[model samples]
Target: MDIHALKRQGMTISEIARRTGHDRKTVRRYLNGDRVPGVRKRAEPDPFDAFVDYVTARLNEDPHLWVVTLLDELEPLGYAGSYQSLTRQIRLRGLRPACTACAHVTQRPNAIIEHPPGEETQFDWLELPDAPTGWGFPTKRAYLLVGSLAHSGVWRGVLSPSMDVPHLLAAMTTLLALLGGVTRVWRFDRMATVLNPVTRDLTPMFAGFAKHHGVQPVVCRPRSGNRKGVVEKNNHTAAQRWWRALPDGLTLEQAQASVDAFARRQDERPRRTETGNTTAKAMFAAERLRPLPPVVFPVVVAEERTATRQALIDWRGNRYSVPPELAAAKVVVQQRLGADTIDIATTSGTVVARHRVVEPGLGVTIRDTGHVAALEAIAMASAPPGRPHRRKERIPPGPAALRAAQVLTGTGQPVSTVISLAAYEQAAKNRNTLR
Candidate 1:
């Protein structure tokens, strides 16, 4: 159209058409003011017009009814329209009502946090899918206790049989020891082992543990796992990147070792940080962690039990062997939090026995071979060497006489039989002669 004005300004029609890349006839028509823009006409009326009212009514009744379900209903009514046609018409008519609830809710923006070196560590539990146990059965529900240093993104994890207080503490201890030091602050979720769900206060045992480590326990707000986001992300990373490919038939010990190896590999990989691209191992080298205490916190649940005559102490329905000398002695069975072994100790804290803890209801007898050998020695030393004298033989009544006695007893009659000692001795001598 601009070429029309160009033609009026003394440019030839061929020149205008060639410059504008338009046909000469089109350019001439535009100059003559006879060309009109083409008008758009509607395509064939949609085949879905007959059922528009039905869909609109249903959507008005329940806006959430799926478009495919409407298609199913229309198909039975002899409507031969495809799903796309029906959805297109429905969308054009705005049949579905706007969901005000979802529209009003807004997502909160995530703030990037910068953790100073050795300042904090985040801890969380990751519940993994059922995996094959050492027994080759897919029955064990494994949970991994993950701890990550916030500054370095370096993490360590341990598999726990449970999320109870003992398991939690044991896993934490193992992870911290692997990391070689503790952070100033231990950030955690509202786990039952650490905080009371109802009161939202720290548990007494966990408080003691925290105090012993010289760390401040900072609990995330209820339902706010993002507060401890490092370990939370690590949870997913470990499950997807490491646990997913774990070999079949992994024992608890093997799984733990695998987790440790995976953590080491992860630490060596390079990661992006605010400072620059660096490996977690590199950052960890610069971290100034608090020195570990001379002794680990005593995070054990203690129970008192008396050793059985067989020198076996019973705990949680399982028997653990102790020294034979400790038989019938009252001893304390101390199960460290999250530890797989139970310590059998005296009241004075001297450990006399240690056995791998067995699950309840197993009725297992965990015997130390040494204890068995010692007990056998003690038994051998106390037993007499030779056979004792045999008692004098005595002859008894025959089956017929015994039956008669039983019948008489059933009749409530007082039945008795007596024999002289000399007569019994003579009968016994006759039997021996026959033999």
Candidate 2:
């Protein structure tokens, strides 16, 4: 009879173990409702044992008798069990609500692949706001060119101007120097500067840069980011790591140094993807940096000059005081913008004094050394001989036409153009007057 009762409940040995607080092995020995010594034979006495008859009688009457109402009624009758205990007993009584089981479980499949050493690296450009370097003129926030290796997880980055041609060249040169050499193949997005816009081809600009550095440039397909997925992922990762290292209100150079140090540390980290491996190990063993050039880059200087009495005579924003012999003549002004250097020349190409452009509008006037020497020679030669007398003044034009002529001369355009513009202006003014 007990076996029949247990079988009707569908109580498995494991469930018996959990419910009765006995080991599964012990419950299994008592399986098939076999009674074992020292083990309770039947259902344990419930604390609500005394109320069971009354509760069962009410449930039989309605089958839907609320557990809470049943507990409330039993309370006055000296019932001591809590609501939870009565609920568990109700579940054991086979009156618990049934729920539909889920049809299937959904899960995401792993998509990561392992790469060998010296395989590939992802490249990207990250722009930051201009920074305050201690230089007198504010050096603006620039870009940091970044590259990350797929196998080793090593990262390289360098600061540069906008990701234009010149800046890109400088950045590539800097990165090659940092990494000890270039990689076999570099993967990056199809940036317009590097790829041909019309054809969507990566064969031209990248080819040139790659040839120079002895590496291959491979661009990710348009709208397909996962082709260069490693670098795209690393780009975000490196940004997070490097952004925090940027100095607050600091110079670009300072922020760059901070990023470099952080990158070095990141490279030293043991790879989470590869068990017991680090970036430094793979890069040092498999990667090699390009050799440095014998000579460093040259520094260019700039200058500013203003036009002179000799219409063309100017140097670095200063008027070259040409001799009276050449006054009202045209010459040439040459200046170097990178440094404080300037040169002046005649229309015939005679070289003049090369001097630095000075600050202030007119305070520090530069007297051309050659012009001064010519003046001194003239004065000395004239001091010994008697000077010529002054000539008489000429007659002026009549006032009636002179005033109108003065207005016409001050108009500056060719007289015909000025007359035409004035006529148009007067006609417009007359129409307004009519209105």
Clashes of each: 4, 24
| Candidate 1 lDDT, 354-424, residue by residue in tens | 99887754668999999999999998899898865568856589987887887877954555797669988
The list of candidate 1 runs beyond 4 A from truth reads 1-107, 135-139, 301-334, 337-435
Q: Candidate 2 versus the native: TM-score?
A: 0.42
Whole-model lDDT values for every prediction: 0.82, 0.62
Model 1 worst lDDT run, 10 consecutive residues: 131-140
lDDT of 2 by residue, 89-136 (tens): 877776433322311212325366655666676778876654443311
Cα RMSD, model 1:
16.3
Clashes of 2: 24
| TM, every model | 0.54, 0.42
Q: Which lDDT value does model 1 have at 363?
A: 65
Q: Model 2 lDDT vs. the true structure? A: 0.62
